[model samples]
Target: MPLYDYQCSRCGEFRAFRPMRDSQLPQACPECDVLCERTLSAPFLSGASDGCLSRPQGAAPGGSWRKMCGFGCSGAGCH
Candidate 1:
């Protein structure tokens, strides 16, 4: 199972744990029980410095690092 971020029109944003088989299925908001749609999320790094993600891998200025996942996968999806 994987945790997915969802946003409901009536409610707001929430996360749910669902199996891959149920990914396409509509999710109900925990607060309002309304159908919620999945939303794109960025990867999170615990204990990372504030500017690490925005900075280049090297110490050079105006440098850019390779993007881990252009598709924007997070958590277990990253591996």
Candidate 2:
């Protein structure tokens, strides 16, 4: 399985794990149950390369938390 990124019109962006055979199918928004469109995103590269670390979803530029919930929330804390 591979992780794919999708963007919902009402709820924003989210990630889905699906089989390669079904990769072209739209994903249902976990929040609003709407069908989300897939986003063209950069491929994730693991390990330190050129002395730089890979940033995760909620990581801020200054090494502080960006307060993202990784679930298309407004960062005020998702329910």
Candidate 3:
């Protein structure tokens, strides 16, 4: 099962776990019981720093691998 985000007009947004087959189906809001549509959301990367996804790779001003990748990379096998 994968977690997805849904938005209800009355109750705002919420997350739910469902199979991929049901991803396109509308989900009932837990708070208001109203059918809500699935919303587009970005994947959350654990331990990732802010701006990691916003910037292109190797585009950091300082050119540090850690800052460029936002992963505090150790330079081992890193391009």
Quote each prediction's TM-score: 0.51, 0.58, 0.55
Lowest summed lDDT window (length 10), candidate 1: 48-57
Candidate 3 clashing pairs, residues 3+ apart or interchain: none
By TM-score, is 2 or 3 better?
2
Give one digit per residue, the lDDT tens place, for model 1 in 27-61: 98765677877777764333322222222233333
Order of the predicted models by TM-score, top scorer first: 2, 3, 1
* lDDT of candidate 3 over 18-50, digit per residue (tens): 799999999987666889999888754446333
Q: Compared to the true structure, candidate 1 yields what TM-score?
A: 0.51
Least well predicted 10-residue stretch by lDDT in candidate 3: 48-57
Q: Over 4 Å off in model 1, which ranges?
A: 43-79
Q: Tell me, what's the RMSD of every candidate?
A: 12.5, 9.6, 12.9
List candidate 2 stretches off by more than 4 Å.
Answer: 46-79
Model 2 quality (TM-score): 0.58
Q: Give the alpha carbon lDDT tens digit for every residue of 1-79 in model 2.
A: 5667777776566666779898889999766788977788776443322311112444443221123442233343233
lDDT of 3: 0.58
